[model samples]
Target: MLTYVCFLVIISVSGGNAAIHSLMYTYLATSGIEDVPEFMTVGFLDGVPLVYYDSNIYRVIPRQKWMNMAVESDYWDKETQISIRFQELYKININTAKERFNQTEGVHTYQVMYGCEWDDETNDTNGFHQEGFDGVDLLSLDLKEMRFISLVPEGIPTQNKWNNDSAWLENLRFYFSDLCIGWLKKYLQYGWSSLKKTVSPQVFLLQKDPSSPVTCQATGFYPIGVTITWLKNGQNHHKDVVLGELLPNEDGTFQKSSTLTVAPYELKKNNYSCVVEHQSKTFTEHLTEDEIRAIHENYLPNSTIVGVVAAVLLLVIICCTAYMVYQKKIESESCSDTTRRPKETNPSVLFLGETMLLAF
Candidate 1:
């Protein structure tokens, strides 16, 4: 069992090494030059496997030796070196953008680089070190030469991923980083342009009097980014202003809102402006404190008035009910008086009858 395990371990290591060497070989072959060693130093940098091929030495540098060489200060400047490039296998087409998102998943792409050592360092055995020569691993070079470059498109993972009700937008951003650097840059630009065109900025102002103090709120949005500012007489009023929450949209865009409290007299008498900037242009709306106050005050809460009217109507009904009961009592007493006078009315009738008989 132990032997079998050992055999499996050997196979795995060999396979990994072979894979690294193969990548190195491919990179060297593409250069069409012969100064590099036949062997390769291979490892992973930021997840992507790197294979560095040397032409002078025909054998790949031992893994242990390569690791040591990468850390050694003496070999840092002397190691075999070549131009490194990232290979991007998958790309997302920008034109295929869905009008509405089902998900906000961003793309993450792998950037693979295979470098070769092509300098005329003859005694270096390319990457293969002789038993006596100082060893070097070309793969673990300095952090400067070997690094990860993120090719995430700017707008592909747009503000849509960050807004309310934007689960789809959020999910899609993860996959957008999978593009190559060139494509990502271009796509980011396009996304920014689209965002600038569709975003709208609004300014809100609350005034204390017709022309005294005005509190202002400004918000701006765009595909790339958004900013809010309060301007009093052409100067930014950052100290007296209150900023609200900066909100993000579903398309990787942003929404920003803020309030600036200032003297309405100054704002109304001077040039007061709220400017919203997008990618292509700036949208501006200007008004005085008095004008803004008129708009805000004009909106009356009618529900309160309605409630008061309903209460008065109920009170009137109760008063009318009580008065009707009082009048009913008065009518009942008058009827009683008429019943008591019945005897006097009978005597008058008798007298009238006697007079009629005499005339006959």
Candidate 2:
């Protein structure tokens, strides 16, 4: 999962207040032999993608006929180059993850995340980089270790080559920090001028399976700092709650979901609601007993209809088979009766033979 945070900050720089852009980008990739495909995402500011990605690759959009195809073609070429580099790095990280997990086969996962936060106004910047294999954080920048820490299958390797070269590490940090700052500056200068539009979420309560938790989804919202929570008895319940990552919508908006597990008795007895906060506006949607009942009631009729159709089809098949068997039995009996009957001679032939014999 790729996650990042970006915000506009008013900070004092050179004895004057300026609108500073704080931005971060987290690049994450996970791969497994089964159950999970190779996936990569580059996230900026609450999981928004500067480039759209899915299905193990980027989603390329076609340019209009009136647009300049040459320039658009170059743009796509650059994106493809970047995607190739990311895939190469992903392979390296996933291989290392496989070794660390001692997994030669079956399902396994690996992830690499690189994040940097920069404030151009204050000239303050921080760098974050980490690698995870099989849900374990293996390599990261450790202040106490004074270098990158690597957790291997054999043991933890605290001493790295970078430990002896602090200047090198600082140079690396500056390089990435400058890159983000420059990108953010360019975005502010040319990409967007007005504030992002605010949109209210369309909330839904979904239960895919009876044994699974109930999901509360909020879609088609913008300006990404939205919070979605499940409340019980007018209070937030975090114990059985799972908060999902924010996702970008097709229209440059945002979407998120949260799930909660509650017993039927508790849900009926206590008041439950999905509370959403976005752009200083709060929206609350309560879950009622009637709504729950309606969901089950709606599902039951469809299931009953399917069952009834199947039963009718089975009965028809059985009746048809029984009729065929009875017809075959009747045919066998008719053939047996024809074969068992005695043959009779012609009466005229017998009378003629008797008259000839009396005359002789």
Best lDDT goes to which candidate?
Answer: 2
lDDT of 2 by residue, 1-360 (tens): 211211111011100122334333323344543433354433333223344333343532321221122123455454444445555555665665566557757655444444444565567755554555554555566533435666544225322543455543443343344444444444434323222345676666766555457777777665656788878899887878898755545444556788888877777789999898876478887877666545544442221122221222222222222111000000111122333321222111111121111100
State TM-scores per candidate: 0.26, 0.55
RMSD of each: 46.7, 32.8
Name the regions of candidate 2 deviating beyond 4 angstroms.
1-31, 35-39, 52-75, 142-147, 151-171, 191-195, 205-216, 227-250, 257-274, 288-360
lDDT, residue 92, model 2 = 67
Residue 9 in candidate 2, Cα distance off native in Å: 18
Error of 2 at 176 (Å): 2.9
Q: What total of clashing residue pairs does each candidate reach?
A: 45, 0
Candidate 2 lDDT? 0.44
Task: Give the per-residue lDDT digits (tens) of candidate 1, residues 1-360.
Answer: 121121121112122112221112111111111432222223322111222223333222322223343233432222332211111001121112211222224421111122122122231111110000001111111112212111123322322222222222121121111111122223223332331244454445555555444444433333324455767678775666665433323222234545555564565467876665654456665666456767578532232122221222222222222111000000111222323322311111211122111100
Distance (Å) between predicted and true CA of 277, model 1? 2.9
